[model samples]
Target: MSLVEAEIKPRKSLFVLKTAKTLFGELDALVADQPANSTAARAIVLAHMRETLVAARADAEAELLATSKGIRCAQNLCNAEDEIISAIHLFATKRVYPVDNPSEAETLAVSAVGGYGRGTLAPGSDIDLLFILPYKQTPWGEQVTEYILYMLWDLGQKVGHAVRSVDECLRMARSDMTVRTATLEARFLTGDKTLFDQMVMRFETEIMAKTGPEFIAAKMAERDERHKMMGNTRYVVEPNIKDGKGGLRDLNTLYWIGKYFYQLKTSQQLVGKGVLSAREYRQFQRAEEFLWAVRCNLHFLTGRAEEKLTFDLQPEMAERLGYAKRVGMLGVERFMKRYFLVAKDVGDLTRIFCTSLEFNHAKDMDLVGRVFAPFRRGKVKIKGDADFVIDSGRLNIAKPDVFTKNPVNLIKMFLVAGREELLFHPDAIKQITRSLRLIDSKLRNDPKANNYFLSILTAPQSVERMLRQMNESGVLGKFVPEFGKIVALMQFNMYHHYTVDEHLIRAVGVMAEIANGGLRKELPLTHELLPQAQ
Candidate 1:
């Protein structure tokens, strides 16, 4: 079994349905005298099931609050949901609409999709389900599916459901990326095992076969769109934990790409697949755990699926997560600071993962080069320097120890990328991150190194982008210690939309945009002044 399946597989010891048999027996007795199709009888049965399951969910949630175990809480919630859904399926087929000697067309395979399919559920999260029919739907199949959905709706459970045949699923997935992504995480819950197995076999062989590169490109485009929608930065004060840039969705995108290419069972397997190093995997795990904890708490606190970490709830969330006041910082401020740092780590992991894909030839380097072609005027000729090389239109260190030999190379690399209008190779960024300790006060104050840093800051092409790369790789902060202090600093004011360092970078980006005529219509005065000042 996959790690996710195992994590959410209801433990017999802590099973939510410990008293399910007795409850079902009582339900059977209650409906014994009434007709199976009787509306009054069905109401009673549904009510009984709803009451019982609601209490079980409450108990599970209370345990979660007491233990403060976020991942386990999600698992147990999913397990509880599974028990409820499975019980409803049985009840619907046997009692509500019994079919004698059902035909092949009547076979239905139920599966969980989306985040629910990953075997994690926060309080009030929608339970996304997919019902797979053998071929065309039969009367009995439709009746069973509707009955199950109605029962869940009556229980106040939000459900996102779809009924499709194997062929229909494949067709829709082929035409729709959202559908394809949803089906990628589908896990069979209950129903016709043979039918489910057949669907999985065909999906892997037909739909997913040789489509890894396309899927990766599509996901990257989707991610870029999402980031743009969410302020195009990870330092938003009231961040959306699920959909914001560097949020849970970003992490899931990494997992999805890895899984699509390698059929990874767990995210840990990404390390083995060379998609992530061991240390980076740990960073991934930590960020995931912290984000999940925050999301779960958000839901519990709001009594709904609230995702944004708004100011009103920040203090309480911080307190609940054990964040305490420090001498100069409030607990909420500290909590938010940690959250932004984790988001930054996620951004790092994304770069590392993409680089791995390029290095492994899983991603098309030519496509990547084309994506960044708009920023290039023409590649500037490189002076005599063996320390750097251009690979697939990105700047890369020629040797692993280039930075160790001269810490000043850290500053020079970004300067070169800016002048040439290129981004850093993932390996180059990794090397810079590892070699941060070598950047000391002497190097920071060196004439050549300072000159390189200034050149990067004032570069006519992609100045903002280069500075962000440097900032993300730890080079900007190391070379300027004052900037390091504000890397993740929260302003704790309603007016400030981003962290201190992010605000500074964004201000620079705005100036660059004005200078380049990108924002001339909106800021003509700034555009006029930018060239003059330079």
Candidate 2:
């Protein structure tokens, strides 16, 4: 058995196991007879490896058809690939540079990084890896890394790989946020566990120490940029499920932050620490599972790593996942609706979780919180019961009933927050979620609450930020029942850049900018004609 098969649990199905055993036996025999330095032998090994991989994928797909669970199917696919990679590694190691000590092969540890490292890989996703050398690249380490890459290329696997020594990893991680995040999620696949252990220890101490604030800031910035690129909405009609604003990337970002700051091994740990409510954790799991299923279906259908829920692919995917046409909607629309809902949930969970981090790690979060320092120093306060406190300009509502006791406080919070250009500390947001039931029809129709919400929409500054927070916290939906219908409403076109809610919020933000004369520089014609037009 291969190292991956032996070390990893939940073995492949009997069919797959037998197939792998036979194919691996053949490959092993081939590797044994071929001349170690012969290029011809390398070609033979590559051919056999490719055959084995194709067979493995076929077996996995058959298993998927039987199980019908995306998570299990994906994990099984990864396992099959792991064993295949191991076989190739063993063959490549023997051919490129025969190990004299045998045990000395432990000097080079091969690990999966990024999505592959996460162990829920989408079919045909790039296999990201790290070749961790005990020291700077020696001849043996160089040959081994080169051989692995060459063979993967020959087999036509899209690969992102890095060759680094332990010290080099630390230096790069300390300097680059992207590298740091990837390194933090690295998983040992084969070879030196001892070396992998040392690298992980140094990673925690040398890379993770004193870097929480900077890392969080960088991730947030990256997320904002990504949202901007994806039309700044979770409800894009043809959303990129993996990288879109409120997609799987957002979920992963939450996990990455939790892992980094709290040393969490899994998302469940967040619930245990009270950072995430049990209900919120379920939301996270459902979103993740749904996205994973959609992604896997997309990959299997297209025979590549395709994540975008494009027009043509929608109907088939919907039908595959058991959606059927209804009275007013097509199966495709229903499916897309559910997908957008998942994205929205991911957004909500992210807001709730990050807010917890900000509140709990205030001292460690100063680097990002500095932007709100001036507001914190001011006396701007909103009406709340004894449950409220201002921490670094963010309103923290400690009482669970703060919102229920006065449901208008939900709309009022946004109104006050936008007017003052402040934020709700994460705890307050969590409280708002618990109080969502209080925002029933009576509260929604209260003229005073309605006016307060409008006032928030027209706030001179921070209108967009506050409105987004309201949407994320479920306040907007509960306050305006109509708005709830369009939370993740898809337009099914390219012209509409955002979902209905996002578009509405963005328009309000633009109106606010115009009201403040902030857009005068860009809208010369509007500025010139405003007085006469009015």
Candidate 3:
């Protein structure tokens, strides 16, 4: 019953799922008391976890019906619930099922569909799971189905348990192992009885006879597709989805999309590594458990179909997570349209996100810091030929065409991806403060000395301009009141050849670059700090 549970990372944003209403207290107990050296132990633990998630999903449906935000999240909560019940049965039943050396059919991964597939869950919640039945491999007369059933009953504890015969949950039943493996998307919640039924009834028999060990191998294909869809956006076009100003809709979309995919991959990774076993119940259960906090909000907004959703969104910090699609184009597209109005600019993200005004002047400085954040933090680097850059007003910028296919905002994309210094540091505010302090000291000794252009601009002045740009560009809305008045102070000044206010404006722009890791590549101020930067 946590207020909100989400996976928030510098690159990933927020991922909050609503799949943990079922296993609330049960999963916590099992993790602490995990039994030793028993296959059934995996199954037992997973079952309780799955239950917690499903129960929570039921609550979310009730709330989603109440608000506009609820409508978006609730759109899929039902499908998620259906998938939850199906997966619970599949995973929990395995705990007591006495199938000898079941070859561990990756239960936890499949069941993870209950939670990760749907949303982020509460901590201590079990992961959801799903299992592809090996029905066609052996004849009905060759194995003891009774033993498997008995084991499931004994270990399941009547909580969250379910299993979809491979033949029942999919479409175009693929038993070549390779095909079957690549088809499962942890982000989507589904129990395709159509395909699952076929797999159990006939597909496995056809493929097993001629399948090669390598043919059935699906380990790498999943990553490749995910990389294409969730990580890279070389050719993705911006989706025309507009959020109509100030709702922070784009941020929310980004978080969900990234969380949606990470939950899928991470769950599979956990199962493959033996940290989790899918044949047991907690598979989908755990996934749901992880989503409790996220759903607490969705349930309130969506209106639960089953239970009461009594959580608030703001104080809990639920929607701010910004997780959705690994922060890739899929998520970024939504964020752009939701917050900004695209315009032509030489900025990193301008093609799809920004206004003619923001692009022409300060260049949506606040957003530039956020978009290039991954490169700034050293989490990743966006590479391009040096020839792709051009200079605008003494500032080195990226070629407009080069960013045509990228989701990274255009204006600052160059410094963010180039051989720039680290700006994505989470402590950007502190560093900016320290750097400005250094410039302030230097100015005291000799006014004619080199001015640290990046450090001099304080908030309210330069920062205020960027905030106004976000609203004008249709990017993000302005909320922090303290930040509002700060934007109000200066009319003009003398030390700056440009208006004193103009000087502060430039200072803020430079500060943003330094914070975003673009200062060194674009500014001469970092000449002394370069060696220690990269």
Candidate 3 lDDT, 198-264, residue by residue in tens? 4434533554333322221232233234434432211112211112111112222222222222222
Candidate 1 runs further than 4 Å off: 1-26, 29-36, 362-381, 460-462, 511-534
Q: Give candidate 3 regions above 4 Å deviation.
A: 1-110, 118-131, 135-295, 298-534
Per-model TM-score, in order, reads 0.89, 0.84, 0.26
Give the alpha carbon lDDT tens digit for every residue of 1-534 in model 2: 110111224645633643444555677678686685687777777888887778867776676555456666667677766777766676666545767675443368898888788776777789989988876345787787888888888889899999888888889888888889889889888777888889999898866777777788788888888999887777667889888977888888887888888888777888888888888877777777677778887899899889888887888998888789888777877888798778878887877777666666666777666411333432234455344556567776645676767788778777766665567766677678778888888997899898987887666677788878888888888887889888876665658756678788888888778878878878888777877976
TM-score of 1: 0.89
**lDDT, candidates in the order shown:** 0.80, 0.75, 0.32
> 1 or 3: which has the higher lDDT?
1
Best by lDDT: 1
- The TM-score of candidate 3 is 0.26
**In TM-score terms, which candidate is top?**
1
lDDT score, residue 397, model 1? 87
Candidate 3 local Cα displacement, residue 213, angstroms: 28
* Cα lDDT, model 3, residue 454: 20
- Return the candidate ranking by lDDT, descending: 1, 2, 3
Judge candidate 2 against the unseen true structure and give its global Cα lDDT, from 0 to 1: 0.75
| Better candidate by lDDT, 2 or 3 | 2
